[model samples]
Target: MPSEPAIASAPHLNIVPASVTPLPDAKPRRALKVCLLGYRSAPYGGGQGIYLKYLSKALVEAGHQVDVISGQPYPHLDPRVNLIKMPGMNLFETGLTSIRPHHLTSLTNIYEWMGKLTGAFSEPYCFGRRVLKYLKKHGRHYDIIHDNQCLSYGMLDIQKQGFPLVTTIHHPITSDLKIALSAAKSWTERLLIRRWHSFLIMQRKVARELHHVVTVSERSRMDIADAFDIQPAGISVVLNGIDTYEFRPLPNVIKNPNRVMAAVSSDQPLKGMRYLLEAVAAVVPKYPDLELLLVGTPKEDGESGKLIRELGLAKHIRAVSGISTEDLVRYYNEASVVVVPSIYEGFGLPAGEAMACGTALISTDGGALPEVVGDAAIQVPIRNSKAIAEVLETLLASPAWRDELAAAGRKRIEELFCWTRAAQQMTDYYWQVIQRENG
Candidate 1:
């Protein structure tokens, strides 16, 4: 095996221009080859995968070539976009004990095994190693690499090698760690949670040293600076966009009067699904026929599942997962109102998607939710089940109010949260970084 690459000195990014302005939308200013890096991506990988898919598609439509290099659970990408597969142990998919002697033939595999054995996640680090190897050979072929929150040492090494690198920190992981700690039932459990999130240490180290960084929202930009100890001035904010065409109001599908909906990712406390469940329980007595459509699966015997059983609301809530995007829009259109009970969010994609689908929303003023929802949706305080129930009753009783909110939400998404606009802004920012680096 080769010796580790030296920790390279941080490169300075020349961002501010003196006296040059382009006439509105002048060709590019320029378009260059872009490589997007992700440790994991969708069908099942969640927001990061969705981000990779849409951003690449949008950038390609803008006339730039985009290549996505990703590890396990590879994303479903646009046909126009190129994909380079980087395989890791993906031990999370194949159980850690499944590693064979053949797997330990390489140092990368060895590192992955050791990390997994010790109860740590090694995907980011392993993927970075593979990506660095690829770039060292093909580094000059691309103009820039846009990383989707894979803040590993290899990214820093690539930057030092004079490759123009830009990273997106969706939100600080510290917020997640803090929230999980508060929910832990014991010291041992808290320690285990900390172990799982220990990757943030590497993330923090890489964040401050990177020359250019982008975040999806103003709130995320501020939070990243504080979490990673970097200057906020160095980060640019680009709002994420919804696919308005896909998530449009289904005029033909009749809405459910006694149904409420939320898209949950896990049983984790951060999503605030527990609070939403509690609120459903609070309102069900008033509307005996009410149903909560949860568009996500809970772990078998997981806390979310356990909570539902304990509350005796198992029959009232339906947990569905693995639905297609086309089907998701249908779920949004049918619900009486969508609820975003999350304690926090980086940009609130679910809320944005729901609003795009013309569903009335009741969202807590969690991080960036207020920014994403604006006055277009109903706002409430976080963790207040009574308030949620009250709003639910009001929305269900008054169809006019629901229609009014639905119209405002649809309009807001069209104006503020469309993918084409987001792609355009991102393209401009990409050019800025490329030109600055070349200069």
Candidate 2:
């Protein structure tokens, strides 16, 4: 392992003034009234949900009036943050293809059902409509509306109404579409994949037209520019943060020498769990005691579960889903190393969280993993089970190297990736956007 390098501050866009600009000699008022919008917010499962939960909490802690308007699987927010629930048909709930008659009672439900049947993702659009309807009927109580990747036609209406609308494109959804298309074995499969990603066309238009766009990483910023045909300068990077207090190392937790843990969401193919399973199988023969623990459930009849069974890894694999945060931290502490083998990531939160927990990381050089891990963790190429197996073998054989990497990973997170710092940076960005709009 190498000596820990200094944590570098993320590069900011030149469009905004530096942090030292002079302002009116007035005491800072109550935090800005911010409305964060998300189509879905499942706190434990997806990145968007996690972003809504933590960012809202951070903003509230900074004295901001924060409201999260979201669809199904509402975010677990800090009690202080207001939540305005926006209901959608949620047709995908039971994994059925088309929306049944039961899904349509109201006009909104009918729209959602019909849209889903026609191969369109309707949640973002419907959620936006619900949001606009709510604001119109109830009252527009928010200063600015911050959308969490729900770029829809209704958002343009909100912008036209002169609301300061800023949308965060975590990364271009085009990447996922491209990956899926390339992996498709037949023309029919490719067509279906493209249909699934048809929403990106709308996202691209909305993202490019929106005045203030925020994203999690520079890699995502650049990719969004390329995918959406917007100038890179049009987007701002407000890096996500880790709650160090919650994710810190638990030395009291027992460390299992042969255990490896990974945090994965089952739906997305870009997560690379299938490849990791292959890597696990390749290495398992050499070390009979080796085992893999997942912080999430394997998708039923999905590629991940099928691959695990195909590789004969059922006996050595344990996936613990829906566990509490405390339990997750305990698992993080118990593991010898945490692996993030994603094919692409807007910002790899799991990598940062594992690092915060003082665990050695084996992350692929996927989208922003390199940026997040720096030199603190071992890096490998994506989708290469052989390479992953080799790295896992090396780490397993070298405890001293693992300890050094773990210490470096923790130090890197403490210095640069804490939520307090992220919140302050985001506060500045929000202030700049509002100032520019109001000016």
Candidate 3:
């Protein structure tokens, strides 16, 4: 095999000029019938769900008829976009005992149930099988099929069947697997982590076989190409967008001087929550009244929970889950600084969202974070508790500096990251795929 290409440096997108025209084309833009597929798309499920939710909403607002075909814990979408429910056992929520006599008859259900019963994640693969079957019968209804990173063997089959297909890989799962392995406490734990990520075998194979693949960041494009052994030239980059209107700052909300906020979806090693906890603990001795607000809940027996207890942060850390965008924005508004301590991120939506809320920001220079934050927020190296703690202390001590960062961060988001702009660019790409397939 040939060697992988060198990862390109992130482009400096300081601000987008307001007067710039749309994509250069002689033809007028056409409204398309778009189908977005997601194995699972609960906004709280992860970034994939958030991607589906916002993208579909933006597409509909852009005058396209969009249909989201999704699995359990479906996305909350604009009323204009139709949602097609694809039901599986949803074993994670429904549990193993929910299985019935008839469920055993289907191979897909059996695979899903069996996989979860062991330690494997089989949702993407099972969803692909169901999607291929659904599209085989109703495939002609939509002009194009775009999958949200559900890279499975069935996707290759769908492409072979002559459907105009495009898949968006948010980031490579190989990164998650590597991080999980390193954080494992025992050989057995490492094996289980590997088992849980076994779907990457299918993903790697399917990614290379797909015709048109897109990623959320330049960093992801490079990592996906390297991880899946595809040519870097084959993958395209479309940065994820923030819903500025929803995440925008509330000037009336009172700010909390000593509150530091973070949004952590899970207690995963990649999230670097442990480091954030340590940072909070380190600074609390000097600032006894400092508060750490977590936007997501942690498993009580999980690493984060254990650390919170060990560090005596039980009173200082307040975690909330399943919050509406309004509540999230309120939290952001109240915070003195929002920190994203992830060891890696594809596009760093939390950083972008916090910035959009006009909260002063401190983010680790994980994958694509610098690309997102630019010069608007202070950035530190990933997994550095001391660095995060030091920055937190400085930001807290000087309200003027925080205000400056808050203004800069919000301006950066307003000018550079908008869902409407992302939708337009994505629409152009869709037409390109359709045109290529036609010829």
Best candidate, lDDT = 3
Tens-place lDDT per residue, model 2, 1-439, is 3343222433445222224442542224456889899899987858898889888988888888898988987888899999988878777774446556676667877777777777877778788788877776663667778999999888888888888888889999889998887777799878878876877787878877788888887788889889999888788877788988889999788779999999997546788887789899999999889989998888768778888879999999998887777898899999998999999999999999899888889999999888889899999999898899999999998999889999999998887677776777677777776777778
CA RMSD per model (angstroms):
7.5, 2.7, 4.4
The whole-model lDDT of each prediction reads: 0.84, 0.82, 0.87
Which sections of candidate 1 miss by over 4 Å? Answer: 1-29
- lDDT for residue 27 in candidate 2, whole number 0-100: 24
Question: Which of candidates 1 and 2 reaches a greater lDDT?
Answer: 1
Q: For candidate 1, which ten residues in a row score worst on lDDT? A: 1-10
Question: What is candidate 1's lDDT per residue for 79-140, written digit by digit as tens?
Answer: 99999988888898899778889999989889888888888877888888889989999767
TM-score of 3: 0.95
Best by TM-score: 3
Candidate 2 TM-score, C-alpha based: 0.93
Q: Is candidate 1 or candidate 3 better by TM-score?
A: 3
Expressed as tens digits, the lDDT of each residue in 222-264 for candidate 3 is: 8988999988878877668899989998979999988999998
